[model samples]
Target: MRVDVHAHYFPADYLDLLTAHGSRHTDIARIPCAGDAEGDIDARLRMMDTAGVDLQILSAAPQMPYLEDAGNAVEAARFVNDRYAELVAAHPGRFAALAAAPLPHTDEAVKETVRALDDLGFAGAAVSTTVLGRTLGDPSFEAYWAALDDRSAPVFVHAAGRDLDSPQIADHGLTWIVGAPFEDAVGVLHLLRAGVPTRYPRIKFVVPHLGGGLSFLLQRIDDNYLHYHEAFPALPSTLLRRMWFDTVGAHAPALREAIDSFGADRIVLGSDYPYFQGDLYTRAVRYVSEADLPAEQVRAVLEDNVRAVFDRL
Candidate 1:
């Protein structure tokens, strides 16, 4: 079965948190929240079928309700996660989810992660590249990471905002175009510098946008890190191989590089739905076949890799 690990959907009620907390990013009016209602989800299912995606794992990314207020964060996590549980129960194989955890509040995040994975049966937890500028490997998130690592949970990682904390990119209208992949690269480098992958070896970190050009930058990252931190456990490039990257970008050279750098085992299917609708959405899936990979590796990217990364699914 083909599984897309990088699809997105936002629950309608959860969007209320945007106004309630004064969300800094995400244009509310333009959100493709068609999956909020059951009727809209039927449409999503039809699109998935048309795109040859047997299952689309949903996540509320770039708009994840990471409110600073613990109470609001907990509330937001509950409602959104509960809704995902509902859809998963209702649809069975057609949909799965990476539950939202209230972050920047470590203990609360831990509780929600436990509940979501241990109780709710989500495939994993969703987190942004940074939690209000706090790196995923920041000391504050150690407990939360520990909990996820202990549970052997897969964490779906993405850039939090479209422009991704940049002024130049936003002004140039290259926000989603250049910003997303740029943030992906920065996020991976941050985690590598902080040793998140080696420290939490059991935690499966699923990243998007062909790892934001990490495959190309691996040598530079290794050289820079080894120059100063030669005593670190291992090269950043070596540790990075442990993580999984989704095949979201259709660039064949990048896809081939990812396969060569990380191996076919770590490349998973990702449609990035709604954002790339109709034919563009289908291309997100079809690109793998067009990349001219072996039939076995193509099947691995489409089906086997995701299941291996999010084994709970």
Candidate 2:
């Protein structure tokens, strides 16, 4: 079964919450397809069919609610997860989901994570590379990490578009173009330095956009680890390999870099959907099938790696 693990679908109501609390850079959350009587699910399904994707595991990222109020966060999270669950129920095999947690509020986020996974039967949960200003490695997220580890949930890490605190990426519209992958790289590296992966071994973390060029830089990091041994209990490359990644950009050379960095068994197909609609979406799925990699590796990235990353999927 071909699964587009990194697909996204924004509910209209949820979009409203994003605007109400914060702009969430609504421009990024905007779906290219025109809205319909059925919320355009039919249009999306047709698009998926054309792309040869059997299923799409939808996620709400970059626009995730990283609210300050736990109460408001819970409400927003429930609304998003409920909407996602409704889509999965409406169309069985055609779609699956990764739940959105109202994060930066640890306890509430943990409760929502459990609800999204255990009650809603979501494959896993999606989080931003940084929640508000706190990196995934922040001390406040320890309970959140432990809870997910206990359930062996696959955590999808996406870049929080508007929340990137870096002044360098702020100007010249770099937020979407350069900020996405850069945040992924910085975010995961923070966790590696914090030893979150080693601390919570069962948590299956999935970084997006070819782990934001980490494949090409792992050796450099491993070499530098000797000077920073006090920060990490394990090698940076070793912990990163334990995480999973997706083929969103579908750059052949970079995918090969990721495979060399961490075998294809740790990679999976991700269309990024609406952003790469039509021909681009088709290419996202087709690239793996037609890559220069070995046949066994191709099958693993297209199918087997998904099962390995999310046992519940």
- Scored by CA lDDT, what does every candidate get? 0.83, 0.84
Please write out the lDDT profile of model 2 over residues 1-313, one tens digit for every residue.
8888898888777888767876546666666552223647787888889988899888888678778777778788898889889989988998888878888888888889899899999999898888777888899899999999899989899887852676777877788788889889988888888888898999899998989889888888888887766487788887888999999887898888899889888999898877887788789988887779999999999888898887786
Clashes of each: 0, 0
User: lDDT tens digits, residues 148-175, model 1?
Assistant: 8898889889886656667899889887
Candidate 1, superposed: residue stretches over 4 Å from native:
28-33, 162-164, 230-232
lDDT of 2 at 25: 68
Task: List CA RMSD, all candidates.
Answer: 1.7, 1.7
Error of 1 at 184 (Å): 1.1
When summed lDDT is taken over every stretch of 10 residues in candidate 2, the lowest stretch is 30-39
Top candidate on lDDT is 2
TM-score of each: 0.95, 0.95
Task: Give the C-alpha miss distance for residue 174 in model 1, angstroms.
Answer: 2.1
